[model samples]
Structure formats: C-alpha cells, structure tokens
Target: MATGLHAPILDWYAENARDLPWRRPDAGPWAILVSEIMLQQTPVVRVLPVWDEWMRRWPTPAALAAEPPGEAVRHWGRLGYPRRALNLHACARAITAEHGGRVPSSYESLRALPGVGDYTAAAVASFAFGGSHAVLDTNVRRVLARAVRGEEYPPKATTTAERKLAESLLPPLDAPRWAVAVMELGALVCTARAPRCADCPVAAACAWRLAGRPAYQGPERRGQTYAGTDRQCRGRLLAVLREAHGAVPKAALDVVWDDAVQRERALDGLVADGLAEALPDDAYRLPA
Candidate 1:
C-alpha cells in the first residue's frame, strides 16, 4: 500500500515541489536545521527571509555557538516565543561542543542536543541525513489522517498510535523524500481550512475521499487570540529589549502597552523565563 502511494507522491514532488531554500541541493544540514526550527510556529513565507538572514550571519553551528544567548534572542526579531531563540542558542552550543560543530545524524544523539525534542530530532535525522525515521509533523499528521485513516483532521496531538500508523506508511527507501512529499501534500493540498482536494495527487487513493469526505467530528480547537493578550504583551516587551544594545529603561517598555498590570506581568514573566534580566535601576534587557 505504501509503495503505491509512494510513487505518485515522489513523482509529483519531483515536478511540483516548492523551490524551498532548505531543499536546494547545495544547502547544508545546518541550513536545513535552522529552517526546521524557524518553521516551528511561522509560515513558510515569513520564514524565508529570516532563514536567509540567519544563514548569512551564522552559517555554521560554531559561529552561533560563539554568540551570546541574548544575541540570538535579539536576532530572532519579532518571532514569537523567544524561548525558542534561547533553545536554538543552546542547541548550537551543544552541536559545536559535542558534535564537533556538526549536526548529528543519529536521532538519539540529535535528541540529546539542547532544545531538540522528538519531532525536531526526527525531522533533522530524516531530512538532512536521509535516515528512516517517522517524521510526523503537523502537516504530515493531517495528510496521513485524511489519506489513510479517513479522518478530516489529525488528533489533538501526536500520540503513540499516530506514530505507529504513520510509520506503517513510510516507504522502505528514500524515506526522506516520502516524508517531505507527504508534508508538502498537506501544506499545499490537504490544508486545515481550505484543502485543494481537486489538485491533490493522492485524491483518488485517499480514504477520506472514498468515504465521501466526512468532516472531522472532534471538539473544535479555537484559533489563538493574540490581540491584547499575554502573547502580544510578551512580543512588545521582547521587541523593546531586542532593539536596545543594553538595558532598556522600564519606562520605555511601559509605553508599548497601556495596561500597567499586564505590562509588568509580561516583563516579570520574561525575567522569570531567563529571556530578560532586571537591572538594579529597574531596567530590563535580554539576558547577558
């Protein structure tokens, strides 16, 4: 079953694959690793320019490892979840210190690197090293759910069962291409809000289509609201700190948001998370 599915997907990908920078033949593993990290919560369009700039600045793990964590946070520039910056810095350090400035090919060694979770470790191993690992990303999950399980959407989160189901569908060889193919299918065809079912390569073989394309029955997960929320406040606070070369006066941060309570809470939360530091003069800046 996987073999039949593999051929069309691979063929389609050969002709129709997005000209992603990370997929370029000349792209290095470090470039692919950075792309994966930046793509975690950002769209491809948004990630492109940032990924390019990051690669230009720090093409190797050794370069990034030499920089301070605060520099990474500052360079992150408007990407939400600054903690990922901290983690990326840590990951670069580990890669440099332990892996001799190279990204590890083994999943276990990759996972042992700082900030590398199961998903990231698997993705890097499969995509960069051509290892056979089940790369169950959000897009892959949605694609598999609809194509194989006859579901409109994936489960709330990755589960052991989902991993097993996805693993069962992976091709025996060139598994990396298969993983990227399915993810691309999900991103371009089987989208969450508006899937272009008509243009899908595997539309005919899709279980959901055979079953009359039933919609998902699970509890509706609401999209996150960012306006006036803690996330927004966090972004504002981080932005100010990011722009400053040194400690920024608290008064400057206070101007970003009107609600004093929320602003203070956001600032304190940043400090608590080690993303920001509080100076004796009540100024804040990215951790030194």
Candidate 2:
C-alpha cells in the first residue's frame, strides 16, 4: 500500500506542484528555512511578497544577524504573529555565531535553533537537506488521516499513532520529495473544508473516500477570532511602533484602539513578550 501510495502521489506532484521560489533548485537552505518559518499559520499567497523582500534584503543568516531585532519586527509587515520576527532574528544570530552562518542539515541541530520544533526540524532536514524524516505538518496529517486511516480528520494535536503512520509511509528513495508531495496533495486536493476527492491522485485507494466521505467526528473545530481581541489590539499598537522613526508617544498607540484598559494590557503584553520597549516618558518602540 505504501509503494502504491508513493508512485501516484509522486507522479501527480511532478506535474502539479506549485513553482514556488523556495522550491527552486537555486534556493538555499536559508531561503527554505525562512519560508518554513514565515509559513507557520500564514498562507502562501500572503507570504510571497514579504518573503521576496526579506530574501532580497537579507539573503543569508549573517545578513539578518547584522541588523537589530527591531529591524526584523519592522520588516515583519503584518505577517500577524510578530513574535516570529523576533524568534527568527534570534535564530539567525545563533546560526551565524554557532553554525558558521549556515542552516544546519541535521534535525537535531535545526531543532536546537530558536522557535524550531520537531515538525520544523524534520521539515528542514527533509526539504532542505534530503534527510529522510517524517514531516508531519497540518497538511500532511490531513492527507494521511483520510487516505490511510479512513478518518475525516486527525486529532487536534499530533499523536504517537500519527507519527508512526507518517514514518511508516516514508519512501526509501527521495523521501523528501515524497514528504512534500503528500503535503501538496493535502493542500491542493484533500483540503480541510472541502476536499476535492475527485481530483485526488489516490482517490481509488483512499480509505475515507471508500467509506463514503464521512464527516469529521472529532471535537468541534473552532475558527480563530481576531477582531476586538488582545491580538488585534497588539497588532494595532505594534503598527504605530513599526512606522515611527523613533519612540512613539503613548497617545499614538491610544488612538489606534479605543478601550483604554484593553489597549494598556496589549501594550504591556507586547513589552513583556519582548516585541516592544516601554520608554521612561510614556513612549513605546520596537525593541532596539
């Protein structure tokens, strides 16, 4: 079954994979690493322009490391999760100081980098260095759930069984290609909301399809709410700092969000998270 799964998915991927810049042969490990980090909880379309600009400005870890952490947050430009900018800055510094300005090829080394986790380490190792490791992102997990496990959806968090299943299906040769192929298949075809099973390469062999495409029976999936939340308030306050030439007056932040209590909490949270600096004279700025 694994062999059968491999050929069709690989063939489909060869014909249908998106021609993303990070996937190009000339794209280095740094580019791939940046793309992976930027892509967390952010869609591909939104990431493209920001990624292009970042690569043009800081082509290597050393280039980014030379700049202040504030520059990273400033350039982050509404990617939604501003903390990732700080994390990436720290990662670049660590890589430049420790790894000779190169992205580590091994999973262990990549995992040790700031903000990198098991999934990220495995993904970087496989996608960037051709190492054979299970790369279980949300897309890959969804694909495996329907195709192999006959389930509409996997668990909310990755489980031991899911990891074992993903590891078991890894191909002997070109495992990286296989891992990405499955991921693409999930992203483009077997989507979460409306899976195009008819267009799926493994439709005939898909257990969920064979079982009549049952609806997800797990816990209710909740959509993220952003508006009127602390997160939105933080983004608004951060925008003020990002655009300012120097420290922004507290009044500048106050005008962005109405509720004084929520606004103050958001600002305080940003300072606590190292995303902003509170000045002595009631001013704020991106970390210096």
Candidate 3:
C-alpha cells in the first residue's frame, strides 16, 4: 500500500519544486542523465552553470563523445570529483557507439554505462522516463527514516530494509513524481538539521515528529573534513590543470600545496585515476 504521506508530499512538490533547467518538460533523457551525474556529491547551486554550459556545448551523447576526454575534464571546472567527468565522457562514448547516440532507457543499459551506478540509473529511469523506481538518495532515506520509521536519522549506508521500505512506500500510479517528491521533501522540508517542520506537509504523519523527535542514539555521524587531507591536495592540483588550457609545468602544480611529498602523491594518484596524464615533458595535463 502507498504510504499515507505520499499525497501531501507529492502535492507539496508540485507547488514548491525548484525551477531547475533539467526539470523542465523539454529536458531530454541525456540531459537528465547528465544532471544526475553532476549532482552526485555536488550541490545544485554549483552544478547549474556547468550543466548549462555542457548542454550548450554538447547537447547530445554523440556531440560529447566526439570531443576528447580531456575537454570534458577541462569543462568540469571546480565542481570537484574530476573522475566523474571522465566517467561521463566514457558514458557518452558508449552511448554514441553502442546505443546509437541516445541515452538508454532500461535500468540495465543505464547501469551498464560508465559511472552510472544503481542509484543514478534508477534516478534517470524514474525522472526522465517515469519509471516506477524507488529512488533512495540520502535525503529520501532521511525523510523515510523520520516520517515512517520514527528514527532521528538513517544509517550511514543504505540497507536492504530501507530499500524494501522505499519500494513499499512507492505509489504505483504516480511513481516518478512520487520518487522525486519524496526526494524533494527530504531536500526541502525534512532536512538533516533544522528541518522546517511547520512547512512540511506530512509533519502530522511523521513518526519522528510523533515520537517527540528523539535525539539519535545509534551512532555518531561525522561530517567530512577537507582541510589538510590528500583530497585537498588533489583538488589543489586539479585546479591548476583545470585552469590551464594546455599541459602545465611541474612548477605550476608545486605552488598550490606547501608539502611537496603530499602534492606529488596526489598528482600521481590523479594520473593513475585517469583524471590527469603525465606528459613526456615531465608536466601534467588532464587526460585526452
């Protein structure tokens, strides 16, 4: 049976959804796929302009596939996780070569594409094609945890129980909208911290709200810290490459971080990850 909270949340989403370009009626499956990939671990505010630029430059999988992989990384800019850029490039190539330039609609086909994981495949299928999939992102998980399970927060990772709950709560007729609506409810109303309970349409039915919103007692959830980490060093190195139109000298990358050993390790890791290439001239450049 559909959860009772489905109607209110779906209605709330219809009235309160963001005016994102990718959400427009005209957005193609490829566009939806691109948006999903860009949104992984990145916020919508940062992804907007990049997505717009990508749409303008490479509107189709064939167009993006024709370009060198390095160009994709170059255009990825400071959105972070340049590896995703490479994966998108690979996906485009696969789509163009194998799928005849169209974003494959089937969950199996989408998941087969490079960088497209189960969540992403499900998201694209649901959002772009109106498939009846249970989109279990972090926000949706939290919403379900609080509103249904009466938990303060979901576990660190998605569990089989959560997936089953999501499937059970999924509405049959309006599955796509329901999936997105649940995600929106989690993103806007049932946020991680300082949720706007009064504005939430399903607040009255929320298990956590009914339970007096007890503090989470299960485990400590630590926020990711970026400062002084190898990831920071990597971001610093990638920034230099992203800014350069061509291969940058070793000296250019050296200035971004004070620790030469960590910086070198980060750069080497990037090369290994296929985000950057080590040139014969001993300089670094984004992969081609």
Clashes within 3 Å, all models in order: 0, 0, 0
lDDT at residue 65 of model 3 (Cα atoms): 95
Q: For candidate 2, write residues 202-285 as lDDT tens digits.
A: 999999999999988999988888889999999899998999968998988989999999999999999999999999899888
* TM-score, prediction 2: 0.98
| Candidate with better TM-score, 2 vs 3 | 2
> Which lDDT value does model 3 have at 78?
88
Of 1 and 2, which scores higher on TM-score? 2
In terms of lDDT, which candidate is stronger, 2 or 3?
Answer: 2
Best by lDDT: 2
lDDT of each: 0.87, 0.92, 0.90
Model 3 scores a C-alpha lDDT of: 0.90
- Cα deviation in Å at residue 283, candidate 2? 0.9
Could you tell me the lDDT of residue 245 within candidate 2?
61
C-alpha root-mean-square deviation, candidate 1: 1.4
* Per-residue lDDT of candidate 3, residues 19-64 (tens digit): 8998899999999999999999888999999999999999999999
